[model samples]
Target: MAEEQEGSDAGSEEVLLTPAQLIRSLEQAWMNEKFAPELLESKSEVVECVVEQLEHMEENLKRAKGGDLKVSIHRMEVERIRYVLSSYLRCRLRKIEKFFPHVLEKEKTRAEGDPSILSPEEFAFAKEYMANTETHFRNVALKHMPPNLQKVDLLKAVTKPNLDSFVFLRVKERQENILVEPETDEQREYVIDLDEDSQHLIRYKTIAPLVASGAVQLI
Candidate 1:
């Protein structure tokens, strides 16, 4: 009976996550700001604040700026974090349902179900976690970007006949996302917006007005 009880306990356990581990993961994901040596040291503390805000249901991200220290918080990252968290929540709910399927059935009968019971604060926490993940991915991309972009015709730059062969040209001066436009059958133009993700120079294009403007540069 004791062995059976121990086995059951192991089967029903939830994995435990340490505060330190959580903080490290979160810090790695939301790191988009420049800092002095002293400031960089304080990231652990700032991450703690984020963790608390999430635990208590608060939205605490600062609006990113474009300049000396460029940081682009992609919306897609936020969505990815939310997606992973939502899946985790569903898995937990499924486990709960297995033990108490009646509760889910009853929830379905109600106007709003158990899933609806999650607080806004909880959702915010999930976003925080995702933001951390995004920041980490961006940092990894930056280290590998090419120093120079060559033979990259303004026309071919945006149209990018070969997506796989295309290189990402980051605009350190502007701190923005690249805007691509197709001017005519012969040419394409691309503009880098300083407010988008700084780590990757996205390959894309727009049509027409680009040719008329004419001015282009590699930065």
Candidate 2:
């Protein structure tokens, strides 16, 4: 019987609160409503200030409506300019294509024909080409030339035998000698007197048969 009475008492003591009572209870428990009025007023003022700035910006946008600036068709303008440029290029391209065959033929003729037949500009170009080609050909030929031979040796090695009907000898002064100079022509019989005696000088260009046959061999 006592336990039942205690349970009833506990149940009856459990307080029920309305919405206003609950809010009052929370304010008292946490002291939330006791904050300084100055802070709350400053927060409200900042919010109002932001709202006023936004309203001013909105009014400025309304006044400026499509008047404060202008926009250009930049990409379209570029494309149009490119198209105009391409029109001139198209003319040049057609001109080049139209004359391509003649140009090719002229080049071929210039390349193959005698250099003397070309115009001044064409001839100059051809000459340059010829000079370059000749240099290249010479370089290739030089690579093929015998590498170990000196210039003189190469000359001697590469020279062909000379064939001539006439034989001639040159007689020129040797230093201070006043002696008669001996020489030979293509003809057989020619003679010259030696100013110096046999002991004082050397005999040169004495023909073998002429001397043996008692022919004049001083020359």
Candidate 3:
């Protein structure tokens, strides 16, 4: 069992995760975010915890002898963790950039008290990117258009995530009676059960909720 430690966030209680557990959580988040058609909910808490763990590891490494085998192994482990963190964040940024208008629209209309899909920093980046995009459009194209045609509906123009796209996933928890919609009128919709540790390729829209709930993991 993993040990608990005091959470670093203000108003947060003890976090029930050890360093190993934190790394696993981060890796899971990274993989899910990387493959999902749409941006998933922020895993900022997990990211923060992992960063804290890495910092602690680095501080200890600073005290180790330079040529020690253990130090070299630890350094390699640190680099791998860093790569995962960087790749996870980069994937999110790419999604935000590609769908800034839609992203901002969702943020704007999010229900009060609902968890945000973006981290605070990510939210700020999305807003700034939206602003910059609009400004560039106005300067390069909108400015030359007639007043009636000057306004552009970004939500309509930008491509939204293809939620219907197929994704490969593994079930972490068993789920029964998942309704799978038919692809065509002649085909019949069916229900299926997802057993624990079972893998399948299915439409992302069909299992998006499960992914967000952590019941399933994308491969």
**Candidate order by TM-score, highest to lowest?**
3, 1, 2
Q: Which candidate comes out best when scored by TM-score?
A: 3
Candidate 1: C-alpha RMSD after superposition = 24.5
Is 1 or 2 the stronger prediction by TM-score?
1
Query: What is the number of backbone collisions in each predicted candidate, taken in the order shown?
Result: 15, 0, 0
lDDT digits (tens) for residues 1-219 of candidate 1: 001111123365443345445443443323211110001111233334444534433232344444423223444444455554444344433333232222223333645311232224433443454455446545765346674632223222222122222223333244334456554679766664543224443332221112112212112
Against the hidden reference, what TM-scores do the models get?
0.21, 0.16, 0.93
Q: In model 3, which runs have C-alpha deviations exceeding 4 angstroms?
A: 1-14
Q: Give per-residue CA lDDT, model 2, range 101-135, as digits (tens).
A: 33334445643322222234433444455456446
The best candidate in terms of lDDT: 3
What is the alpha-carbon lDDT for the whole of candidate 1?
A: 0.33
Q: Is candidate 1 or candidate 2 better by lDDT?
A: 1
Model 3 lowest lDDT segment of ten:
1-10
Off by over 4 Å in 2: 1-71, 105-219
TM-score of 2: 0.16
Task: Show the colliding residue pairs in model 3.
Answer: none
